[model samples]
Target: METQEANTKKVVVEKKPLEKVCIICAKGSLEDVYATLVMANGAVMEGIETNVFFTFFGLDGITKKQMNRLHTATTGNPAMRMPGGIPFPTMLGGLPGVETAVSGMMRKQMEELDMPPVDEFLEMITAGGGTIYACKLAIDMFKLEKKDLSDEVEDIITIGQFYELCDGDRTQIIFT
Candidate 1:
């Protein structure tokens, strides 16, 4: 019995930690955009290989004309709070200019913490050995060319290609 237990213990394999992470950003809202950025940055900081694929409206976060001007999603966002510590009313979110105001407030708060803007964040991530990819289907659907994206975008690729990038024994895929 002791010999049999020893042989079974040798057959058990030790699991290794994740070595790579692939993040998919599919929403355009400020919160959604920041969530991807934070996770990708954190992964790179831990010496894990990181790649972020921006699809659908999330492409706005990497677009040159809209990167720094992205807006918050106030409607249906229960977590939103006003600057004065009051909860943001859902009805108020529909009023004209309310989204702009909320976006500005969110920007101000991020700035207060010395967080980089979207464009700068992309740069930082790329500089830290992370990669940014734009969805080819979204680019074609939106009639966007390569020039429409920020310079930090490493490539425009399909979902299949994105999967290939994450192909490995311990690659994690996260959708934001």
Candidate 2:
């Protein structure tokens, strides 16, 4: 005979919500940038302290000249496909105009889904009290001035300063 109490043992664990989120954006492609933005935005919406740091090629998302003109990388993307789910040929993806057309289609699809433009998305995130930062090392390497970045950028800081913000028992550091 088996005892029901023994078979149905109870387990208790501590429940805690994330208090802060530090997200790092290191890629420049449209999809990657959007992924970072979406996560940061979602965290802000949840009333969590959100800090977004853009570095390397990801600076394109905050660069005033390129923010609105970001494009998706169709070539070498294994999951890239046509509108109806047909697999896109890698060779065709590398052809002239194909990348642009595909990126345009992607942006169009996002727009149809009511997604905001990069600049507007940044604005929304900031409006929600989320902080945006540019990596100082990347800025120096790219020869970019603070004025070249989007107004939404709160500051340019070193990775060390960024890590300082990651301190907290309930903080999450996300590298996207």
Candidate 3:
């Protein structure tokens, strides 16, 4: 009986390798936009087919009028800091020009590191073979047209369409 039990074969289940990724960018702030770009770019570098769908305020990252002018979220961002690396006080965020100042500082630091602006980042991601899409409902809600979006945008698609693009055994979806 013991020998018979030892003869039983163990079946192994292996997960499929990640072949595609769908990233959802839902915020418009500088940090959020950069996060999405970095991840999408990284996915492409890993030889994964990637798609980035921008919805809600995330549309700002792909909009021609706002792409390069995204602001930092000051009100509730605990990670926000000053040039000296001091934590930014929440109360100071309410002062006029404070948000702009912080945003300028962040932009300068990013520039020092040779990070591209939002528009350029989008261009880079697309050039690297990643696709960018805008949420159709979001476009309607924001009163935006195709002409108002960056040329990098592949299309404005519904959520169902986005899901369809992500439909695959080895596809992963990330919501930022």
Q: Which numbered prediction scores highest in lDDT against the true structure?
A: 2
What C-alpha RMSD separates each model from the true structure? 2.7, 2.6, 2.9
| lDDT values for all models | 0.93, 0.94, 0.92
Most accurate candidate by TM-score: 2
TM-score, candidate number 1 = 0.89
> Model 1 lDDT vs. the true structure?
0.93
Question: What is the lDDT for 131 in model 1?
Answer: 99
List model 1 lDDT by residue over 1-176, tens digit each.
99999999988967798899999999988888999998998899899999999999999999999989999878898888887779989999989999998898889989899888999989989999999999999999999999999999999999999989998989999999
Candidate 1 clashes between residue pairs 3 or more apart in a chain or in different chains: none
Model 2's TM-score against the true structure: 0.92
lDDT digits (tens) for residues 1-176 of candidate 3: 87666565333445567999999999999989999999999999899999999999999999999999889978788987776789889999978998988898888889899899988888989999999999999999999999999999999999999999998889999998
Q: What is the C-alpha lDDT profile of model 2 across 1-176, one tens digit per residue?
A: 24656555533345799999999999999998999999999999999999999999999999999998889987889999887889999999989998888888889999999889999999999999999999999999999999999999999999999999999999999999
Candidate 3 residue spans exceeding 4 A from truth: 1-15
**C-alpha lDDT of candidate 3 relative to the true structure:** 0.92
The runs of at least 3 residues in candidate 2 whose Cα sits more than 4 Å from the true structure, single-residue gaps closed, are 1-12
